[model samples]
Target: MSTYSNDVFLVGTLYGQSAVSVSQILSGAGANVSSTALLGAVLNEYNARLNDPAVQNAADWYSSYRLPTHQEIIENYNEVAALSPTEQLAIGKLGKLTSYPVMIDLGPGNVQLFTAIGLLNDYKARYPNSDPLNLKSYENDYSALAADLTDTFSDTTVKFAGLMVQKGTEWGSNNVANWNDLSQAEKNAFAVFFYKVGENEMNARLESAGGNYVPDLAGAPIAQEFYSNIEGIDSAVVNSFGSWWSNALGSEQGFAEAQKLEYYADFFEQNPEAFSTNPMFLNHLISEVGHDGLRQLANVFDWPLCFAEGTLISLGDGTQIPIEDVRIGDVVTSYESTLPLGRLQNKRVTRLFKNEVAHLLDVHGLKVTPGHVTLCGDGQFAGKHVPIIDILLSDGALVRENGDLIRMAINKPVGSREDQFVQVSYAVDADAAREGNLQSGKMRVGTLLFDRDDQPVSVLDCIQAEGMTFNPKTGLVTRAGGSPEPLYFFGELPRPEDYILRRSRETLEGILTDGEWEGTPSQLVGQRLRQTYSLKLH
Candidate 1:
């Protein structure tokens, strides 16, 4: 009956009369979701919430128009490559459940709640002294009265369901005082409006009828705790509950997660704008929550903040080990901006993405990815990083061959500046032209371009990637894998690096002024060590 805009598919195999849909329907089922076996388990509990599944938008899930019958999901699935940004968020991260237009109509039960409430109020007015509590059980004359109200379509299943909604709605509307204002007996009177409302025969009815509902549900007295458990789960809340199931047919021991997120639920419920800005905030911090709140939940943060292979990862014991050698449960020195000296904490590794990056830079003697964040100084926002190459070419970064300091203003001649300062530019067509690599009409129009500072500009070095953009959110650069950096010399095809340097006095002058680096290709000898590293011309 509901026409969902984002038409979510439940493409799954039928296990006899039972059906098992894809796990993307649930939040907390991360991208690394392995085993359709887990899907079965998730759906088992999900289907158990048979009556009212999700609270609208409460649970997390990835919804899409068409379902891929990609059998790859049976064992492994990283097919986020083909998903929309919203669907990607649902799959790639945890805690970020997306909402679709899945809704409940409530059918006959919609106005039934108000009707029951009105009937109870009229009865109270007729018999002024007969308290509602007196009719708590179907005993004596009350039995006949309760039977009159109990029918197939009404409160036979969930006894007092409408009455509880009535009392809650009325109490809030009429009384100045809240639930805390109610006396103990008065609170018990409201409790009398909520009960189990079903019997063991109801389960048998579901099996025999082969349908969703049970008509003649036998009544049973509910425990005191059951009222509190089902508290506040009205139509709105029930709708929310119904939505999350389809949203992320998803996580964890129920009690443990409930206890952990109890305080969080309170805070976020009040301050919803925190999530309204960036819905992924909680999803991003989910690892931190696991580490801080529940150690059993496996803390793993995919830190794009990487270190080079040989770099040292300091241990809490004051000893150092290579970054690759570090293991989970090892207390490593993790920095907190509040403390000048960082504190040591145990960190666990969740994922390890192999980055054989083309743009590698040598920071001092350490080899690091140009994208690495540790290259930047502290206090910078995450991902706001400067390439290591930028720092090395700066004035203070480079020393003269005689060990003397020199200001390296790229705009001026190579070796002349008052104080140690340098300027850099994104335009580097001159660098390529000086080498005579800029063939006919290849100056600016023939090559790839980038939007620097919102203005279109060229990169100093050419990227082997196909797509180029200032911000990756729009068009992520994907390398078309051939050579990382093609070799050029004397404007010849695939020549050695033996040409170009004269006109580009701005960028190259720092190294050329010092005259400490080479200006020609390496000889085909045993090994040509270039600046403590091998320069294999491809």
Candidate 2:
């Protein structure tokens, strides 16, 4: 028989003949000790499992594994968790109704029995005194209860399962293998099944099963978007973003009310040409001007680009101090010629930075020689080169504009120069990378990062989040969320259709930057706020 059938049988027999060998072992001190209750627990669990639509549909395909004894479910978790990341992914996608069940520690009680108790508790919470096994059938011949939730697991469930599976693999010695062998459909199936485990059912599976799957403190079920009819914003996203923003507005001066109006007014007049090219600017302007302006801006862009909160350190020659530690009047290194690294071979600063001269001066500091550095003036890349007393960072290092010493990360060759102007290569934390459409490899300058409700967040704030990287010169942001993995940035201008969404995002960002904003109910801010005010420009 298949491994599934074999394992199921091993555990199933424990339920079918409650008083047999399975019972003996269960009652033995060496086993779970709740032997007598195994049969009844299994029956309840089996009935509960049947209530799941996926389980019901999957039953016929893998009937041999269905209705296994309570003991079998626990055992299967161990085997599934033991699969390679590749196989785990496969199993996660295509294992029929397989889901990572929740585990609960019930102190001194029989862990297995307590596990069943947890599942029953969950059923009670959802059905509220109603029996899961006795739900009324619906027109589709399925229960309305089943229709209430998506068959695919919620985001919380998915993240929780990932934590358990990854942790279990870490604690246990499991071989890593090429799980990619599974077809795409199979991988998708695993994700769907892995997440479908109910919060309570998960607790039961863990307690009863001898498997190891502990939940994290942060992994507790967050209401997220479970209740509200908000699009684009959920609790998870809101909580993280709101917490970050409320803390950020307190320190950021640019967010002050007066500064915001000037920032936008100057931004619009100076960037009128770019208004068509960069929709984010328009969106922010509209948000500041109110309704009609919001609509106008929405007409121009396609996605929201906001700054996230975080620190950005760029590697530069000693002339520039890292932006995080910049002090007034700090001398920075203007430029330094170093031996060619990989891409720098045979290329000078001129050829490397390319048409990027404008961005270079505006965003980075320069180092010319040892012990001497100076910051570039604002909009230096736009052909108005003015040195500032402040320090700057580029690439991945910390330095001072006074040409003082600090540490530095490796730097790549990527900048350009023309006539009297020179633009040098620099790195950007992913949080600060430009957000725009992508074409070849080049990206247009724009905002990036959004709040929980799909509203734009500040790039500065995003930098604080783990795993954000930005290449100031390259203008790229690399992000991996869910199974949808892609390096997104503002590579090119978006199509007309996307401009409205983009503009709305800009308006929300402007509003946040303008107010000394603090966290509010995310569902309300993201969902209700958007619906009521049409804050989304589009």
Superpose all Cα atoms of candidate 1 onto the true structure and report the RMSD in Å to 1 decimal.
24.4
Best by TM-score: 1
Give all candidates' CA lDDT scores: 0.28, 0.28
Worst 10 residues of 1 by lDDT: 517-526
Model 1, 236-260: lDDT tens per residue?
A: 1233222222333233323244443
Q: How many residue pairs of model 1 clash at the backbone?
A: 17
Prediction 1 global C-alpha lDDT: 0.28
lDDT tens digits by residue: candidate 2, 1-538:
0111111221222223222333343224122212222222222223333345354433322322231233444455456446544454343323434453212211111122212333334434545644323322221221111211111111111112222222222222221122334343222222222233333344454555545543321232211111111111121123311222223335343244344344434544543322321223233343445444443343343222111112232333323233435333334323332521111122111100001010111122232211112322222111111111111111122323333332221111122110011111222333334433233433222223346787644332353263754445434444445332223433232221122224332232332223211111011112223343553464
Candidate no. 2 TM-score: 0.17
Which segments of model 2 are wrong by more than 4 Å?
Answer: 1-92, 97-243, 246-297, 302-538
Please report the candidate that would top lDDT against the real structure. 1
lDDT of 1 at 88: 36
Error of 1 at 354 (Å): 5.4
TM-score of each: 0.24, 0.17
